[model samples]
Target: MTDRHNAFLSDMAEATRLTQSGRLGEATALIQRRLGVPGRSPDGASPADASAGPHAVPRLEGPAARLGTEAAAATAHEALIPERLRENIDQMMQGLRTLAPSLRGLVGGGLHAPKPGGLEPEGVETEGGQFVERSFSNAAGARDYKLFIPSPRSGPRPLLVMLHGCTQSPDDFAAGTRMNALAEEEGIYVVYPRQSSRANAQRCWNWFEPGDQGREMGEAGIVAGLVRAICTEHPIDRSRIYIAGLSAGGAAAANIARAYPDLFAGLGVHSGLAAGCARDLPSALSAMRVGAPGAAEPGGAAGFGAGSVTQNLRVPTIVFHGEGDGTVHPRNADAVLAQAGIDALTPRRERGSSGRHSYTRTRYADETGRVQVEAWSVQGAGHAWLGGSPEGSYTDPSGPDASRAMLDFFLGHSLPGGRG
Candidate 1:
C-alpha cells in the first residue's frame, strides 16, 4: 500500500491498543493531535468550555468513566472500526493492491466505492413537475443537473438549488428530500446538480479542497455559473434564490454561499461541516470525526478556527443536525452558524417534538428583529436526513419535515430591496 494509507493504518492500530487499555481519552487525543485537530475530545465533545492543552485528553465522567474505554469507544462508533477492518481484511488487502492504479482520488470518500450505481430517474413520471435533465459548462468545469420546473407561472418565482451528499445522485436526492413535490405546491423551482465520479469516486463535492473552496473557481464556481444560467433561462426572482444540501453537499452549499453572497439570499446545511473546516484528506477525516478544531467557540467574528468567512455580507442560514450523528459530529452544526457570522448574536431558543424526535430550535435575529439564522438540534437522530423518504439513501422519516421548514425559512428572507 501507499505510505499515506500505511501511516493511517499504523496510527489507527495504535489507537485501538489505547482503547483496549481503557485509555480511550488518550487514544482520541493522540489521534487528534497527530492529525493536527487537537481541539476535540474523546467522545466528540465540544471544547468551547474546556480549559486544556491542545493535546490534553479530558477525563470521562459518570457512566462513561465507569464503563472504561472499550464500551465508550464502541458506543461512539470508534470501537467497531477494528472489528470491521478485521472482517474485511482480505477484501481490503486485495482492493488496496489495485486501488493505486484504479483510484485517482484519496479523499472525499474515495478510499472505496461503497455505493455502486449511476444516475437513476429523478422521480415517478406522475410527480407533476417537469424534472428535466440539463447540463451547464463554464470556465471552471462542466456539470449535469436536473431542473424541476413548477408548471407555468405568471411572474418571477423563487428558485432553490439542492445539493446531494456523497455517493448520491440528483435522482436519489430529489426522491429522498421530496423537494420537487414541494416545489409544485409552493410554486417555486428546484434544481439538483449531479457531481461527476471523475471529480471524486464517491461523487462527493470537494469541499475539503482549497481549490474548490474559493470564489469563481473549482466546484463553487461551476455551481454558481449553473445558478446564473438557470436564472437567465428561467423566470427566477433574483431576490429569493436559496441553496441547501446534506453532508458533503451541505459543506459545498456553505462554501458557495460564502463565495457568492450576492447570488444566494439564504443557505441551509444539514449534518455538514463549515466551509474551510478541512483543507485535505487528513483534516477532513479529523473534522468529520470530532469537528473542526476550535469549532467549540461559537462567538467568533473571524470565522471559526478551521473556517474562513470574511464577507461583511452574511447570508441568512438555517442549520439542522442530529445530536447522535456519528459520521459528522453535532458540534459542526454550531460551527456552521459561526462561519455564517451569526453565532455571536444571542438566540431565542425553544423546545419542541416531532412525535418521533425531540428538537431544540434556536433563532438568531438582527437588531431590526429579523431572524437571520435558525438552528435545529434533533435528539436520538443519527446520520440520516430528518423526515426524508426511505426511497432514497441516508434518510430517516422519523423527524420534523426538513424540506418544509427550510422552505418556510427561505421564503421569509430575500435580498435587501427585493420582494420577499
Candidate 2:
C-alpha cells in the first residue's frame, strides 16, 4: 500500500481507539482536523494551523484517501462498528487502484472538469446587480462575505441572508438560485456569508457543532454580527430582514432564527434539519442519515442555555425537500416544519408543476389566517436546490422555483415588534 494509504489507516485506527476510550470529542476533532474540515478550532484558527500542533497527524493524499478518512472518522463514535464503512473503504481502494491514467490526471488536477451548462461562466463579473465583497469582524471572529445590491436601489430595502451548502461558494449559490436577479426586480439587498474552507474543509457552515449553534457565540454570533453590520452600513429594513439556506446552511439558518427570533422576520430551510437536532459529529451524521425527531416547541422557556429563555416568538418559515433526496432524508423537512410550531394546524395542500418536476405544497396558517409555515415536497428531485440553474453545483433544474416561493413568504412577514 502507498504511504498515504498507510497514514489513512493509522489515523483511522487511532480515532477508533480514542472513541473506544470514551474520548468521543477528541476522536471527532481528530477526524475533522485530518480531513481538513474548517471551523473545528475554538480560537478562530485555520484548520492547518490548528492541526500543526502537538496532536496533529499527517495528512492523507488523494480523493480516495480523503473519502476513507471521512468514513473511518465517522465510525469512531459508533457504539458498534458499521459494516458499511469497511465495505466503502474496500470499494474505494479497489476503484482507486483500477482508475485509468486519464482519470487519475483529472483527479490530480483538482477535479476541475467543466460542469454541464456552465452556470458559472468564466470572466463573468456581475449580473443584474452589483456584488461587493465585504468582511465582518467581531469578538467571535472575522468572516468574509459578499453583498449583492440590485440596481435602482432606493429606500430601506429588505435584506435577505443566504447560506450556501457544503462545498458550494456564494457565487455558485447565487447563480443556482438566481436570487440576485429576483432581488433586482424587487429592489432587495442580498448577502451571502461564505463559510471558509479554512473553517470546514467542505466549506459548510458548522451548524451541527454545539459551539456554532447558540446565539452570541461562534459562527451564529458572527453571522448575526454580519447582519447588524450590513444594516448599519446600508438602508436595510430591520423589520423585514430574513434568512434562508440549503443543507448545512439551512440548518444554521434555522439555528439563527431560533436563537435570535427578534432579528429575523422569516426563515427558509431547504433540505435541512431542525434546530438542536445534533450536538456532535456522530449525532449529526445520524440525523442526516435517518432524520431526527422534531423539537417540542419553538419557544417555551427552554432556551439554548440553561438559564436563558428564548423569546416567545415564531418566525414565519418555509421548507422545501425532495422525496428522492438520498443525501438528506425528506423527513428532515417535516422536523423543520414542526420546529416552527405549526403542527397543530391543518395544512392547505396544493399540487403544482414547474419545469419537469411535480410538487405538492402545504401551507399552515395561524388563527389570524396568516401563513406561518409552508412545506414543499418535490416528487422526483434529489439533494439539490429546487428549480435551480444547472450551471451551479448540486442544483435540480426540474423542481418548482424555491427561491421565488421563499422570497414571497419572507416578504409577507415582519417582526412582531417591528425590529428592535
lDDT of each: 0.72, 0.70
Q: Which tens-of-lDDT digit does each residue in 255-333 have in candidate 2? A: 8888788899999998877777776676677768887643434444232342111222367889999888777788777
Q: Write the per-residue lDDT of candidate 1 for residues 132-243, one digit (tens) a residue.
A: 6656678888777878888776799999999998767888799989888999999899989888645764568888887887788999998888888777777889899999
User: Ten-residue segment with the worst summed lDDT in candidate 2?
Assistant: 54-63
Q: Best candidate, lDDT-wise?
A: 1
TM of each candidate vs. truth: 0.68, 0.67
Estimate the overall C-alpha local distance difference test score of candidate 1.
Answer: 0.72
